[model samples]
Target: MRLPKLLLFIVLFCFVFLSGAQIQAQETNEKADAKQAEPPSSVKELKPVTTIDPLVPLDQLRIMVRPLTKDELQVEANAWFELLRNKSRQIAAARLGVKKTNEAIATNDDQQALDSLKKAESVQHMADEKARQTEEELTKQAQETLGVDVAVDAARPDPAKAEEGTTASTEEKSATTADSTSTPDNPTTTQSAEAMKAAFLQNINRLQDERTALSDRLEVVLTSLAAKGGDVETYRKYIAAVSGLELDTSDASAAWSGIKGWFVSKEGGQRMGWNLGKFLLILFLTWVVARIGSTVISWLLERKVRLTQLAENLISGTIRNVIYLVGFAVALTALEVDMTPVLAAIGATGLVVGLALQGTLSNFASGLMILINRPFDVGDVVTAGGVTGTVKQMNLVSTNFRTFDNQTIHVPNNSIWNGVITNITANKVRRVDLEFCIGYSDDFEQAEQIIRDVLADQELVLREPEAVVVTHALADSSVNIVCRPWAKTTDWWAVKTAVTREVKRRFDQAGISIPFPQQDIHVYSTDASKGNGKIETVSK
Candidate 1:
């Protein structure tokens, strides 16, 4: 009995000991999990935590009060919003972290609870901060777009929302009340739920008044500057800068300075010579590249591309322009030169020139259309603009023409495009037409046969289309016959001239008298007193 009892007691002791060990193992795992947990990469985790806020790049930055295009103003607004959002996040995270740290100590280093609370707290903080910043940005952008001080919806922070996050220990709650009196950077004047809203409204109103006064003054100053010439516009911009606006002050002076700055302002003028050398090198390279690109484009068009001559030329010209423009832009940027003013000047000059040469520009446009449409090309005999001439050269603005009288005429493209164009030499083959007249008494068949024989004998005339001599009409004294022959365009005139000469000669040899204008007349003589007249027909 004693042995059985001892065995049973040992079994019970082992079971209790194993169960306690299992419980201790579970507790250790829970502690490990708590320690392993960590916060995510938040806005605070960014580098250089204590440095000044990241402002927008100088090239992109614009004054808050300045006039800007829609796209530009949007970029500016987005930049400010980014900066503000980042700044607000960092502050909120820090404040919440402090609240968590003090609460963790109050809970006697309850690490597992603290970690869960931290995760919830940080997420909530980020969301709230984002919503707040977005509201502010929207309000500011609205006012800017309206170009006036529009009403802004106030940003009111709810205390219940901020403090309603994770539950804290009793000790943590007491501390929260004392710490919540302080804001992110400024202490709250009042403990109301809308304290933030009140403060923000007050600040915005002050800013609105200041900006309005400056804008009003600026308008008046600009009006005065418009009347006073000679760099008064430049002065106006500088004044705008003083009034907290960014006006583009890039003028001739700025342009020159920018150019000079490229060469002389690098490394305390250490690379002055090198910079100048680079400028010259870039120019030389640009010329070489432009020539090479032009040659390559021309070769491609000649061999591989199946476009028309005019299209080929246009493509080649455009490619070369691009090469030069790009190469120069790169070189200029390397030297730190700004081309804004130069480009502006060019645009302004072009506008003036275009307005002055309206007719010429019209001709140019019409000429381009003609070239594209290909109504007629060089060496074609075309009747255009009420003048018939052979095209000598077809230029972009006009067509050079050589008239039959050996006079050169330049017909503007406008006149030709608007007129009917007849291309006489467009066909490879042409018809030579000739007419002959013979006495009505002459055998019409014989006369026709004689003309056909003349045309058949002409070597320059074509035989496939066939030559024909047909009696055309019976006139008062003659039978009009037409002799038609076909010939190559180059041989048309020669064939016609030869056929005409031969026909006349053959008719004479055959005794077929060519008609001369003659009439058979009748003369009647009678004594009036006799009241009788004898009529006689006379041939004259």
Candidate 2:
């Protein structure tokens, strides 16, 4: 050993000396070349060294073919580096082309959005035009049936003797109509004229009342539009549209006064009129009631004596949601809004989505069932759908579990309901099972006593059921000893771990052998071992 060590140190010293000489020779040569170099005016030609052999395998041979100079090696390294850089640039250019194609595809998406916007605008314009035409036809029919033109002509008498002729003519016509009514079977033309005149008079009065109400409503609408800084023509159409509504007001004077001042007042008022105002008020009241109702429900749930955490969550989420939905429906009806269109839209959307996600809907329905039934709560250790873990959270489609090994798993609710659920922590008490084998040469009683002692040492091990040690099986080489101890569910792991450690440690100290499978072989020498039994040629 000493000789080998000395030889290694000698070889290392020679290598260091040769390397140092090479470095010194190179440095001297560089200094001499620098001293002989002329002034910077002349350009020096750079000639690349041609050849340098790469490192060869060390096991081949100890002798080297003339080693290349440093300049030659540097030239070769530069040439190989340039080739690699060129290859990398080519690869980068290919990647850039792919990126440009992706940019073009993204730009094409804007055209789709623009097309949708244009379609929506066109639909809105068409609906507006159709509503306008329908309102105009209704107004025209009401005007033609009411005899409004005849009523207006009758209201004004001739310029000369207007008051005297109006009173006398009205009395004479009434008297004539009353006499003609006595002979009902033979009604004359004058009677018919009087009847027609009375019918026209009643119809004219009704039309005048409708026109007055419409005028007041129009004024209110015009005031609102003007306040909003709408264009003159926009205000005119708004007034005309409202006039067609034929709104009836009890106090015309008060209504017009309210409308005129509403435009000047700081407070926004009668410009919206009673219809819109009542609608907004109903909506606000509904929201407030819903909020208060939700708060009261939360209070009630909190006050309950046997309220579970899950029930509390359900009351706030599910029950409160139902209340809000009903409240909104009631508010919409109170405002006299047509809910049919909205309902139809909602039904169509639901139909499409339900058809698309049949599996997801099934899981959601199963999840609701699980929540209502509550087979297991959070932190319950369960094995379901081929997975074992503690329940972390329950969602609409799936349940999340955090396994003992710290892996997060998502189990579908449908699978949980369809598969077997083994809840280990459902019971308060659990039994620990243990088994060990001892060599046949070891005393059975000693092994049993050791296992019992190990069980007794663990404080978490329960004493009520008592620990048991039995000779479960007898094998060819060993006797199997089975030990059982009862413990609380929470203390199962602690007792199990403590007993296992103590059993191993005490067994080693007591010289008790834990047996494992082994094989034995017998060898016979041809010359020696055959003398005892081979005299009769008997081999067992």
Candidate 3:
């Protein structure tokens, strides 16, 4: 009985211990689950409000603004103004966050402060990205509503002006507030597009003023924070991010007024007039110098160099044009005009023009080659570019040809250069080749002698080289003779015609017949009754 009681007590003690351990394990699991469910204290504490309050999200604002009618744009402009105000607040909040984080770090020397600083920086980065996106969308909207140039000009902030003011002047503040109040609440209200654009521009100006003020405030805060041994680098980066949001407004009328005032002012007008006079004087001097230089070059080329007319003209004209260009550039410099952009533009234009005129350039290059190599010149008879003609004119792009029939042809220099060039009158003398045919029965020796006699009788034919008369070929009907005579290039045609006529006359007198083409045909007929075939031959 004592042993049973002891066993029962042991079992009860073991069961109680096991149940207690189980309960403790359950409580530990619940605690782990609760810890996992909650976000880190640092992350929760530093989560930035990413939205611009009292205005739709940037994406929603884009949708709302995109399809708005011209009259409706004014109403939306108010919302945009409100959006800008909220953005200014957001920037202020971010600035405050940085100050607070810095203050906390200064006061607390612990890991928690470091973690908070890191989280705060992360949050600030996120805020900056959102602000950038919002600014871009607003800029795009403005650009779409107004002309791109006008919007860009209006939005382009003047750094000098921005640096001058930390806060808007009382008058400027009142004007901005007044402009914001002028925007109509009703979307159905009729308003001119111009008026709406003016209002939008006014809002953009307000936004710029607010941003300048914020930047000034941030500058002070950053300076103070830096004095307190806080992280100023992060604040500086924030300032830079905000500075990128340029949304200033400039009045066209004010710009025009200023320009008019400058022109009307005696000192300004006189200075401008003086510059103009200087530019004109420089240009005139340049023109006079260019003229004198060109004349000198022409005289030198003609007298000293004694180049061909084309080469002389090309050189003189090129020098004259270069002089003119240099003079123009000098004139511009005298006027204090920037030449960098001009030169860049000219270089770009030259590249495009060169690409477009590749064939013309090729012709020009070929023409230069022709001039340098002296292949053919004006008045020379040439067989080139598949055309036989006298070269009437030559230029960089093309060569003019006058055919024997008196038809003028314009041949590209490239075409003439790329092919075989036969300059008939390039040399002082040329050879005239003539072929004559005689009957097969006629004596070949007699025909050859006749051709030689004809060539000798022609006064224009050259004798030093001696003429050639030989049996060239024997055809079925005739014997062919080749007569080659050398003569002055100028008298070549006359010599050829005279020799040919004399040879024909001599052949006719000597009874050497120039036979026509002949053929012999044979026909066969079969006699059926006799079983024989009769063959007949006919000559034609």
Candidate 4:
């Protein structure tokens, strides 16, 4: 009985001990697991204290073993012992002897400066490691965040649909507000909802602004095109041409097909055809009108006129230009163009061009004056603008003259209009002024009679003016005489030549001497009184 009781007590003791030991073991395991779940404090520990927050982020820990304070050294020794318990751990550690030597320096009792520098260096290293870890973690998080935002932006709704929806929402909101205002009981609720609606419709206001701007620009472009001769039919034809282009639509059939069909309609074709027909008609009418106008102008110019060739050319040019101008204006009107602005623009351009060509305008005006006044007709010999020549032709800018030497001269009309003009051929008869000189030793009366006889013999010499020869000047060797004779203007040169030749020949025959320039001189030599030198005599 004693043995059995002892055995039962032993079994109960073993069972109780085993159960307590198992419970203790389980508690220890749970504590180890808790520590393993946590992140490291100083990174020297074999396991961390809590699991890290992946989203919050943490960088990898860096550790450096070095000297510590005496108190911290004891803690480090204990920590090393603990590390030994987990000997399988691979971690950097300073030897105890080396740590003690370094810790003595760190305590700095006799070497305080060295110890302070060591402490500062350790602190700085720790701070730098922490900053690097934080920076790395932030970079990783920033990359992930950026990628997410990109995905979100790419998935955002299309702007066109958003604009349409926003517009509809605004209209609904306006209607709802009007309804709410009609019912007074829901005023507060309506105001709150209206504020929310206003916030939501901000994008709608912006879209509407853009749409208004686009519409205004479209109107401007349309007006410009129309003013410059673009029409609805032109637009329709352009659309038709673009639509007829063949496109491979396997990848995008629906969208392109709808676009193509919209432009290739029967209305578009008819519009283009009508425009083409109208263009051809306008062109034909223009040609016919131009031909008829030119013919009429030519006929008018061909009519009898007292004007010269140059004047006739000027008049005909002016008439043809006027006719073409009128025709152009009429054609533009027929084409349904608004000509008011066009005329205004043309007037402005003309004003600018006229100002720029002021000198040319003056020349043209002077040419016109020359044509109208008839100062000298063509084929008349005139002296004007320092030039003596026969008039050839007068153009808008210059007058042409053929000089006696067979040289052609272009004189500006401005000079001709503002200078003296001498028309030598204005009358049927002209004077032939002559001068003659005879020797003082000769008989003046005889020389006079000889000139009169010479003039009387010439057939083309005129007697109406009554040629008179008289003694005009007395000189050292000769007496000068003036001869005046009237002659037909056409035979002036011939008559003058004949009379001069005859008078000289008759004087020679009649013994009326015409002396050359003569001089007489007396000379006395100073040496003649002394009878030392002989005087030289000279004769010619």
Which candidate wins on lDDT? 3
Tell me the tens digit of each residue's lDDT in model 2 across 40-131. 43223222221111111222211221242333223322322332233223223322322322332233343332233233223322333343
**What is the alpha-carbon lDDT for the whole of candidate 1?**
0.58
Better of 2 and 3 by lDDT: 3
lDDT for 530 (candidate 3): 100
Colliding pairs, model 2 = none
Global Cα lDDT for candidate 4: 0.54
Residue 363 miss distance in model 1 (angstroms): 2.4
Overall lDDT per candidate, in order of appearance? 0.58, 0.55, 0.62, 0.54
In the range 349-413, model 3's lDDT, one tens digit per residue, is: 99889999999999999999988987876688899999999988877898899999999999999
For candidate 3, the TM-score is 0.44
TM-scores of all predicted structures:
0.43, 0.43, 0.44, 0.41
Q: Measured by TM-score, how close is model 2 to the native structure?
A: 0.43
* lDDT tens digits by residue: candidate 1, 12-96: 9999999999999999999888766643344223221101112212322223324443333333334433433443343344334
Q: Count of backbone clashes for each model? A: 1, 0, 0, 6
Best by TM-score: 3
lDDT of 4 by residue, 1-540 (tens): 999999999999999999999999999999999999764565443321111211121121111112222233333223222222221111011111122223333342423322332343343234333433433343344345334322223564533344345434534544454454444354433342334323322332332233222222222333334444444344323323422223324324323533343344333334345655665666567667666765566566557555665576556666656666775666555544457678789888998999998887888999888888877877889998889999887778888899999999998888888899898987889888887777767789888888988888888888798888889889776788899888887888887888888887898898777776776544556775677755555432
Q: Would you list the rank order by lDDT, best first?
A: 3, 1, 2, 4
Task: Summing lDDT over every window of 10 consecutive residues in candidate 4, give the lowest-scoring window.
Answer: 87-96
